[model samples]
Every structure is written in C-alpha cells, then in structure tokens.
Target: MSSATRRPNTNCIHSGTRIDPAVGGVNTPIHMSSAYLQPNPQAPETCYPRYMNIPTQQAPADKIAALEHGEAGLVLATGLAAITIPILAMMRPGAHAVFQADLYGGTHHFILAEMERLGLAYTLVPETDPEAIAAAVRPGTTLVHLESPTNPTLKIIDLAATARAVKETNPDAVLCIDNTFATPMNQNPLDLGFDVVMHSGTKYLSGHSDLNCGAVVTSAARMKAIRETAVNIGTSLAPFDSYLLERSMKTLAVRMERHNANALAVAEYLERHPKIGAVHYPGLPSHPGHAAAARQMRGFGGMVSFELGDSPEAARAAVQRLSVIASAISLGGVESTITFPAETSHYKMTREERLAIGVTDTLARLSVGIEDVADLLEDLEGALAAL
Candidate 1:
C-alpha cells in the first residue's frame, strides 16, 4: 500500500513483513544461516552471502524502506555503522560536509576525528539556522547532515528549507536527516525533499533496546550504493539482530503513542514545577518549534530535557534518588532513562565546548517511556525533594 494511503499503525504493523507461504507463518522467519542454499542443478542462483537474495536482510530492509517512504533501504550492524557507511559510499577525498553543531556524541566524534583521519573536510553549523549552514558550505561540500529535535538539546531544524537551499546552490549535495528521534511514524524527511533518511534502529524503531541496527533508506540508486558499502565493509546486520529489531518495530505505533503522551505530561509537569529552571520538549507551548513540530510530526516524541535549579552535584544527587527512572545513556526503551549530557554524551567535548553548544552539567535529559505518568512524576518529585 502507498504510504500516503496507509494509516501509521497499519504501516508499522504490516509495512515490511509479508508472511512466507512456504513456511505458512504470519511473521518473517529468522533465517539464521549465514549462507543460503542454492537451488538444485546449480539453478538460476537461489541465494548466497555477501551479496543479495537473503530473506533475513531483505525482510527488514523492505520494511524500513516502506516505513520511511523511500524507494529502497539498507541495514547496518549498528547506528554508527549506518552513518559511516553512507559517508564512505558518497564521499570522496577532499570532499567537505556540513553538519549540525549538536549531534549524537558518537556521530560528532566520527566526523570531527575519524573523518579528519580519512582526510575529509567538515563544518559544524547551528542546524536551526539555514543561513549558517549555507555559509558553511564550501565549493567542495557534497553533504549536509542534520539531526532534528537534536539529542539532549531537542533543537529543531527546518528540514524542507535546508534541503531546498542545499539543492538549489549545490544540486549534487545530498541532504541526509537522522530520523531516529522522530521515527517514520512521525516524519518523512524524504517527502520533505531530503535526499536520504537515516535511522538509528537501536532507538525507537527497535523500541525494546534489545538490538543494535541502523538503516539508510533512499532512492533505489542510493540504496544500491549503500548496500555495496555495507556488505564490503562487513557492517551488515546479523539475521538474529534483524529479527529482534523487526519484532520490536511491529509495535512502533503503540509504543510511540505512549512515548509521546508520557513525554508531554512530563514536560508540562516539569514546566510548572517550582524547582525546574527550564524544560525542553517540543510539546511545551513555549518551545521554539512547537508549531513546526505539530506540522511535521504526529506526536512530540519520547525525549525531554530540563535544567535543574541547583548545581551539577545536586543534579547528580537528584538522579541518584530517582527509583523508577534509570540513570543511563541510551533511550527509547520500555522503561524511562535519564542522563547528564555533560558526563555521558558530551563529556568528550571540553567545558567551554559543551557550554558553547548549550550542553550544561545542569541539563538532565529524560527519555520518557511507556510507564505510568503518575509513578514517573512521583519518582521525579521525590528526587527533586532530595535535591
């Protein structure tokens, strides 16, 4: 079915999976074999590894392609693998890339350090400003990477505007969006004119945090390039991990709904709380991009961040007192997670660097889950009291 005609729930449940009549099963069976059997008589090439025709790989890839509203998809072993493969596939020596100032720390490290080692050029710009991005673009720039509702800070970028600007001045430059925060159920950046859409399947797409997989979905031609890079680099996801991620994706619609609701409630609560210095969530009325978020996303999303009234030590104490919310780094699980970006995600950046980019020690990012809102609030209240 066309993505435009399908409901989000229908897309999530049935997008990538078609039961195999041979197996007579409702779900895609996990084809665990690294190698597949070729038909008898060395027939017209039945299947093989390191190439194409693997049901395990094809199943998830098809699903993500459909969900992201792209012509095709490629799966990788991990989110960073997904990110890196595309860079390698698309970039040449001396090519420059423009990226958001605030990105997932691992991604920043990859571009800032690893890309330099590989002799590539990059510029960091505030993704919210299209003009800044335009200014950063050099004659050799070929890619503009963005992360909307960016990690920890939840900054929003005008994807459509940025894509148009990039394509207008640099027709060959491809705009890639990290769609992990707002899953396919929420936004389709390709439809917004982005050239490619990437997902960290380790997050909301997998839902359960039980698997580590990444996806790159785009036009068929782009998919071919990504596939070549993925297999050649040995970054393709294992069948078992693909199965787990596919299973988790089936419930994406329901989980994202709860995630949005819980996040909204938490944002509102924190907004009015006496101890909270500031609350950052797209659902909040005061948020800079609340209207744009409503326009592009069906829901606000699962993540939230707030500044504490006390010092960094007090913030640490508050998180330590929380019983229901786990103090951890990754997010988008059945349970809530909280972390201090200064120590967890942005620690590698120096103090001045972190402050310059708005990641402060007092900033506590919360990944709201499918938990009871009241219980989570109570836990936060208790934590605040301790602080």
Candidate 2:
C-alpha cells in the first residue's frame, strides 16, 4: 500500500526506510564522506554533509515531512536554529510579523532583541483570539507565528480560526507553528492551513535526549528558500545525528501512546491534590483550551504544567524531594523530568514579563515519560508531602 494509505503507526516504522542498493541492507547507511566523487567537471555540485540533502539526512527529513503532511523538509542542528533560520528567510527588511505573547523564552528574546537590528517590525498578541491576531497584522506583515499547547503554560490556540483570520487580513502572510509539544503524533498544523510546521527533534523526536536536532516541514518552494539560508549560515544536521533521528522515528508512534496515557494519568492525579493550584493540561476538562484541543488534536500530549499553592520556594523544595523524576531543563525524553520554568526556561525574562504570560514563579512544567503511572504518582505524592 502507498504511504498515504497507511496508518500513522505504520508510517512511523516504515515511512522512509530505503534499502541499500549495494548490499541490500535493511537500514539506510550513514554516508560520513564529506564530499562525493564528481563524475565530471561539468556535472552539478556533488553531495556534501553541509548540504544536508544526502541520503542519510534526507531519510529522516522525508519521515518528518510525511508525518507533517508537507511536501518537503530540512533538518538543522538545534531547535532554536530551526525556528530562527526560517524567520530570517521569510521576513526581510521592513517586513512585519504577528507573534504570540507566550512563547519559548529563547524565541521571545530573539524576536524582541534581534528583529529591530534586522529591520523587521513585530507585535506580540497578548491573547490567542483570532480577532486579536487579525488586529495585530500590518500591510507589510509577512509572518504569523503561533504555538499551541504553548510552552510551560499549555495554552491551546485555535489554529484553523487563527489561520483564516491571518490569511484573510493579509493574503501574503505565512502561518508558522511550533509543533514541538504536540508532535506530529498528536497534531499536524499543515492540515489546519498552517504554511509551515517545525519541531525540536532533540526532545520527542529523538525520544532519548541523546541527540540535538531540529526540523522544518513545508512546501518545496519554502524549503528551497530555507535551505539556501541554512547553507549560507552553516546550520545543517550532522550525518550521524540524522541516522539516530531516523532510528528514533521508528518508535515515535508507540512512544507517544505511552506518553499520552502517562501524562493524562499524572494530570488527573495532580488536579486532585490539595497542594496543587492549577494544572495546565489540555487533556483535563478544567483546562481552558480543552474543547478546542479535542476538536483539533488526536490526543492531548505528554506535557503538563502546574502550580504550587504555597510559594516558589515550596515549588523548588518539591522538585528536590522527588525521587523518580529528574530536575531537568529540557523535555520529551523517555525518562520523566520536571523544571521550574520561571527559573530555567523563562529565567532570561524579567519576573513581570514571565508572569504576564502566565509562567508564574510557583508554576512547574512536567514532561511525562513512558514510565509506570503508579510509580510516577507515588514519586509526585512524595514530593508534595515534602512541601
């Protein structure tokens, strides 16, 4: 059967596998050669690692593009590079962009600190409402950026509504979404009219936290532009790292299933705990964005954020007391990890800036792993008791 007709789980395992023509090997071999031998002087440029369209890199890129339902993809060295390069390519001098207020701290800093230097104008919308986004657009607006189940806050934006509003307001604008939290297993922004979808392959895509990689999925034309920028900036993924990412894609569907079940279980437990304040998980009925999430996503993702009722100090103490979950900065690994976003991910922002986006000092974000749900509950309960 064609890849388009196969189930997602089937696609995860077999989407981009290419048999070795020479040895008939089941796995695609990593071509570590820096340069391919030129057949003749008149031939086109030969394959090189930095070009990143070689077999090894293209294998994983192909899988990700299939998962996102895009025509093409490019792999980068890091998540920030994946996001930044695309912005640089799409928004030229004198261009304007509309961005969500609550964004990954690194992305927020880059836009506010660098856009002016690049001669680009931007506005951050405090709310994700379609009308608010429509109001922020300018005649020169070239990009509309969004993050659903937003970092640490789990705020779900209405993608279809936002895309419609932005496109109607500015026909030339391109809608880009950061699909790190939801993953292609749970959501595909392209299906909802988004122009591009990006992922931090370091997190869920690798699923083991051993590799750092990023990917952008979009039309062939957009990818060609981004690839040109990536080549000029020297931000291509390494050959070995691309091989690892390809191996990880084989289990993405199964891993995400476990992550979804584990996260929902943990969210329910936290919601009932007396020490917890608000649990920001779209799977929960209490979440403000639950209904919209249900409509757009196949499953609520593995990420959950919550607040302690006491103080920031109490929140830190609980993190220290946890026995099973590690106190870590990143997320989406097979091992459960938690972090105080106010101190880590959002630390660069001022206290007022963090709170303005709902990342309070007392809030903690958890990246649920594919572990036993009972053990996770016991570990969390022990930490809360310590607080």
Give lDDT per model, in order. Answer: 0.84, 0.90
After superposition, candidate 2 runs with Cα above 4 Å error: none
lDDT of 2: 0.90
Ten contiguous residues with the weakest lDDT in model 2: 10-19
Specify the highest-TM-score model's number. 2
Model 1 lDDT on a 0 to 1 scale: 0.84
TM-score of 1: 0.95
**Cα lDDT, model 2, residue 323:** 85
Clashing pairs in 2: none
